[model samples]
Target: MNKTINQKAWFFVVPVFVLVAFNAVIPLMTVVNYSFQETFGNNVFMWEGTRWFKQILQSERFHAALGRQFLFTGIILVIQIPLGIAIALSMPKEGPWVSVCLVLMSMPLLIPWNVVGAMWNIFALPEIGFLGHTLNGLGFDYNFTQQIGDAWFTTILMDVWHWTSLVVLLSYAGLMSIQPAYYQAAEIDGASRWSVFRYIELPKMKKVLTIAILLRFMDSFMIYTEPFVLTGGGPGNATAFLSIDLVKMALGQFDLGPAAAMSLIYFFIVLLVCWVFYNLMMKNEEQS
Candidate 1:
């Protein structure tokens, strides 16, 4: 006799669905509505299908922001993934120190994004701040507020400090899940450290690393708050990623139509790129 599944479980899910609809679906519909129309004061709206989309697609500012966004994501992935993996590899698989190491690695991830930015902003000041004063004393003119390069460096460093812990934690989790039997087998085969990592550890860690990379990419690409707080999208828009640019368009310029259109397009671009990365990762997993 087959057991009947509970139909009442749908009732349990309904509240979550309604919440999602209220929070996500409603705002999304509002954006779509704004995207296809032009508006003036007094609630006047004119139908302008795809006009905003086309305008945004052709805008140099949007393209520049997109390019910068990609570059930031790329740089972060390059640094964080390798560094996290190295750290994970070095971390004790099991010992009294394991908890200590894990907690230390995770400490940075606990800070709120805006507060991290504020902390860094103060820390990196070129005069009164310790970092800035030390750099200045060392004969380095470090002024993030004025120099575009300095601003970019500060933003990148802040992001790395804030988010690298995520990669490390994920990588560590993956490392922990790996069975001791594999290491034992590798030892029986007299495998070197490189060989063990290459043939066993790396393959085992692939799934988690993919997750880490994807998460880092998406977070870095969509990053707004920390950089905005630190640089305010200055020194002259040098650190203006796509999210910052979109905010400027939507709120600063009050161009709701184009902002909405750009938001949809940006959403899709993120989705598409993430899909490609996911597929590539799966293919690698299959191959290994």
Candidate 2:
């Protein structure tokens, strides 16, 4: 006799599919529509084929913005991942102080993005801000508003302080998930701390590190609010990344066509990078 399989589980997933279609698929389709068309108010739209895409691809502005976006993301990943892992390793694995350390590590992440920017803006003032005053006292001519280098330093440092905790949290979770038997085996073999970390801990933590890197990459690439609030993409457009440039084109100058095309390209680059990361991570896991 043949057995019948239950097919009623479809009901459970249908709502999610419908919701995603409404929220993501429809909006993406609308963007694709605008990306290929030209508009000049009064709901007027003309078919422009790939004109906008061609324009964005040829524009030096987009090239510069793309370069800045990738640079920001690269810097963030380089700094945050190792730093977070080190911090997480230093924290007490199990003790009364663990909670306190975790809470302190998390405090910066709780602050709102715009507020973080505003706080940094005030705190970096040459005369009034404590940080600026302290840096100046230490013989560094740090002034985020007036100097391009200072602006870059403040932005990178602010991002580090704000988001590094996320990496720490993820690393800590991964570290905690390792079974005690692994440690026991390492100890039995008289493994040094470095040997244990290299052979046992690093492998276990790879999955989490992959996730942390991807999150940091995407967030840094798409960052707008804090940098915008802090710099206004000023200091001579030094902090103007792709998102900022897209906003300026779409809303500031009302060049919807180029903006829409650029946005689509921007979205695809992110998706492609994320896909590559996922594949590489899985391949590494398989090899290990």
On TM-score, the leading prediction is 1
Each candidate: RMSD to true structure?
1.8, 2.3
lDDT of 2 by residue, 71-113 (tens): 8889888999999999988888998998998999999989999
For model 2, the local distance difference test gives 0.91
lDDT of each: 0.90, 0.91
Clashes of each: 0, 0
Measured by lDDT, the strongest candidate is 2
User: For model 1, what is the C-alpha lDDT against the true structure?
Assistant: 0.90
